[model samples]
Target: MDRIAILKLNGFLLVTIQVEMHDQLVLRLQDDLTQMLERTRASGVLIDISGLDIVDSFIGRSLAQIAAIARVMNAATVLVGMKPAVAITMVELGMSLAGVRTAVNVDKGMVLLHEAAGLEAR
Candidate 1:
């Protein structure tokens, strides 16, 4: 029952998925993330998936669901550290990850969030 921890930083929620996850873990993450968003009142979410070697359809849809939920909560979602192969595979698998924003790395992700939230450049 290892769950992904959501860290709140400078008005944003940061989650780094370090291992391949099962369906239950993914569902729990989505629930926890939305709850965190509401409790913390964070303006954005930065998801770092650099350690993940693959992005299966289930995981991709979960990401999109998280992003969608965050959007309705008035929080932006930025997915960073997606490998080229994973991105290609995601597309090939028909997961467009629509409505989800992405960045090259966490630093750029933060910038994207700040810009979207209209915060002063950090």
Candidate 2:
């Protein structure tokens, strides 16, 4: 499938973007994530982007939007595993990605997610 998979894990949702997302995929992710959040009532979200080597302005903005929506739905979002080049590109493109917290790896991302959800990370 072209869609990304979002796994529910320990009161949080894990979304690992393993593809170069296009517009439709990004939009669908937002919709699907929203439904998942409501259905699962997750406390936090952890999105891994290590597989992504490039990120355009639209994708960056979409990530921020998804995090915002999650926050509104009572779920915090932590983005993880961003490539250095992708981070630089986003800054150069003037994308702040505000409201979305970030971590260096999935392990750290889970810690942040758990912390935000007021759960003790093991």
Candidate 3:
């Protein structure tokens, strides 16, 4: 099975979604992230979706689910690097992406995570 490249940095998991995700791939990612979170005991998840031009409903739901599951595991999820058009489209599509925090970019997301976790940003 193909796996998404998830990087661990300063106790946070960084997931940069660079490709169009199908349902199976998204499911696999959710599973992999959950397991990784448990193993690493990470405090936060920062998902960078800048490469994705559009987030269809499936992907949006997957992101929401990932955030919710991460929260249940005591980890916060912050979505970042969304394109302006993508954000507009998501809203037009009526996907609120509830329960998920967001940042304008990866850098901002990192800062937000650090602040939320009470960790000093480097």
Candidate 4:
């Protein structure tokens, strides 16, 4: 797995992960994302997953968990850049992402976040 990248901008946090789609990556992401949410006290989180081509059960569950945690932290989480093929595969596998918000791309996700947080996009 590659290093996870995190950036903070305008009270929103962006996380990018470049790694194999696997259980370990999901666990690490959970920990890292949880910490980021708590430490930043962010209004929203944008997760970019354009690099990932596959979405497994473990990864999907981890994402759901992250969204839940963000809510508890008083922040909204938006998943962005999901590939169409990966989306189809996830649906076929009966993996339901409960309590998770998704956008077609990062720009849309940022807009959603801004609306959710009642902030004007700059």
Supply every candidate's count of residue pairs whose N, Cα or C atoms clash at under 3 angstroms. Answer: 0, 0, 0, 0
lDDT agreement of model 2 with the native:
0.93
RMSD of each: 0.7, 0.8, 1.0, 1.5
After superposing candidate 3, which stretches have Cα over 4 Å from the reference?
Answer: none
Q: TM-score, each model?
A: 0.97, 0.97, 0.95, 0.92
CA lDDT of every candidate: 0.93, 0.93, 0.91, 0.85
Q: Of 1 and 4, which scores higher on lDDT?
A: 1
How high is the lDDT of residue 53 in model 1?
93
Clashing pairs in 3: none
Clashes of 3: 0
Worst 10 residues of 1 by lDDT: 91-100
Candidate 4 Cα lDDT to native: 0.85
Worst 10 residues of 3 by lDDT: 96-105
- As a whole number from 0 to 100, the lDDT of residue 7 in candidate 3 is 88
Prediction 3 TM-score vs. true: 0.95
lDDT of 4 by residue, 33-119 (tens): 789888889999999999898888788878888888888899999999899998998898888777668999888999999989998
lDDT of 3 by residue, 1-122 (tens): 77789889989999988887888989999999999999999999999998889789999989999999999998889999999999999999999877788999888999889987899977
Evaluate model 4: give its TM-score.
Answer: 0.92
